[model samples]
Target: MKWSMRIVMTLTISLVIAVCLSLLPKMDSSIGINSPYHWPSNRIGQVTDNNLPDLLVQVPLQMRIRKVELSSTRMSLDLSLPKNADSTSVYRDLYTIAQTMLMKTKNVNQVWVRVIDYSGVSDNASTQLVLAMVAERESGKDMDKSASELSLIQLEQELQNRFRITYTSKWQQRYPL
Candidate 1:
């Protein structure tokens, strides 16, 4: 009789563990509603009044936005600078300026940017560096590819037109290699 009881206890414990494990995923799904993890939602492309406000013009699947910063200065050849010149300050200034301008752009949902490196100075009394960020487009099944392409192209053109200052020598760490 004692042996039978022990066997029954083991089976009961195993069943309990199995039941708990099965419930874990359902609990996780419930808790994930407010989580930041992007999940595959059945309504990924569903249009609704709430999502309408968030829509920034049907982003494409592969749209890219690049951030560019320029730094330029003039120095005499006699002024010998160190081989590793710290140009962090120059890059920071350019990044701030470019970010501000990009925030005002339309159709682009997000913009990311960073400084690459100092391009270098030329005989024309100018030392310049560049910073940039490439943002990918968030695409959905309901999104229009053509519209997304146009938006990306327009954003690129706008940046070029507005901040097309020539750089003597530019160095960048992150580029679309």
Candidate 2:
């Protein structure tokens, strides 16, 4: 009888210890403690840039875009256009594309579209269109660009087209808001 009692007490103690040991890891994780033995450093964190969502590839392919560079808040696109494409039409198309593609992205608030000549030569000519998130979000009634602003973009496009001027660099970063 005495031996049986000791065996039962021993079993109880062993069961309690087993249960506690099993729960230790879970408790540590719930409280934000990482166990070095169980958690691998590389597997436990956020994905790096190389593994970012496939938006980078999908955006260019879907839009017939030539090149795309994306950061947290801004995206720059290189689009191939005919040598003498109409400035207004090009701007409209670029604005529409930028708005549609980027507005829904989680953190993107601005898009820079560069209309490059079909020749793909840096010296040929390009038109740049920059769209801001705030302006895009505003009601259509309030979203109109000033006449001068519209004319300025048009003029720049015209000058570049006429002179076959191109920027030395295809991509330029705009100041962050």
Candidate 3:
């Protein structure tokens, strides 16, 4: 009887250890509520010098681009902002947000970002901003160009798959709120 009890206890302990071990990896991969932010070292999206600084260009804008249209050096992006958010904040947010999105595509250049519309704003909370970005692909096939292009394609696919994956991989480790 004592041996049986010991066996049961051993099994329980083993099962508990196994369960705990299994959870470790999942916890690592699973998106945590308050995870540290991380992003690719490289930066994307260059603010055009010639273009007039509109409500855009503010660093670290809260809004993200919803759509991007490209045409040569001229490009437009539809941005989405948080509720009650300021245009300046949106503008600032655009830089990092655009970098996160455009870094995923190879044929992006001369990005033109704009606050196309405001969506879902609450008097109590900051409004969400939606933005559109339009840009062109740089031309060339040299090794550097080819590499950049490949990176762009890969980044684009990653972003298209899920902005959170790309954005979190690049910036915050936590899931976007």
Candidate 4:
């Protein structure tokens, strides 16, 4: 009878532990809705008006997102930045935003980010395309290609090869490998 009681107690303790472990994920705040954990959604390419903002807010954009256009294999983000914003940071923000979007959308292989700034007085208010970047995920063929081929290759070089500055000559010159 004592052995039987011990067995029942052990089983009950094991069951209680299993139930608590199962609830751990739900109790954790790390995966809250405000976070960017909702990746590779089943409805990726089928983006609608309701989900676009949620998708974009995943990244800490340096500027305000003006518009976003999604296609079967591509995502395009048009953003507006303050005229006095730092050029170097904005340049880096381009890559950061693209990477997050690409990772979040399984079907999206390419991401294009455009950042525009406003200038001139009210009468002559003008918008200037200050910076832009285009990034493409690794191709099937490139997957087999080794980065070891280049002796001096670095992470920045590898990232540069994957993503590139576009639309603005001045930014392309200022930003480098």
lDDT for each of the candidates? 0.37, 0.46, 0.43, 0.62
- What TM-score against the true fold does each predicted structure earn? 0.35, 0.35, 0.30, 0.55
Ranking by TM-score: 4, 1, 2, 3
- In terms of lDDT, which candidate is strongest? 4
Q: Model 1's lDDT to the true fold?
A: 0.37
- What would the per-residue lDDT of candidate 2 be over residues 33-132, giving only the tens digit for each residue? 3422232222322222443333344322222466767676656667765544444554455544443433434445555566654444555354443321
TM-score for model 4? 0.55
Q: In model 2, which range of ten residues has the least summed lDDT?
A: 131-140
Q: Kindly list the per-residue Cα lDDT of model 3 for residues 61-145, writing each as its tens digit.
A: 4555456564544456656544566533543344344453354334444456555334444552563323434332332111132
Estimate candidate 3's RMSD in Å.
16.1
Superposed Cα deviation of residue 141, candidate 1 (Å): 23
Please write out the lDDT profile of model 1 over residues 22-50, one tens digit for every residue.
99999998877644342223223322233
Query: Which pairs clash in the backbone of model 2?
Result: none
Better of 3 and 4 by lDDT: 4
- List ranges where model 3 is wrong by over 4 Å: 1-16, 19-23, 26-59, 64-77, 80-100, 103-114, 119-133, 139-177
Error of 2 at 12 (Å): 44
Local lDDT at 148 for model 4: 31
Per-candidate count of clashing residue pairs (backbone under 3 Å):
11, 0, 49, 0
Q: How would you encode candidate 4's per-residue C-alpha lDDT over 1-177 as one tens digit per residue?
A: 999999999999999999999999987755664344443333443344455666676666667887788887888888877665665456446645665655555666887888776545354256667677778766211432233333333434544566776546644544443
Lowest-sum lDDT 10-residue window in model 1? 70-79
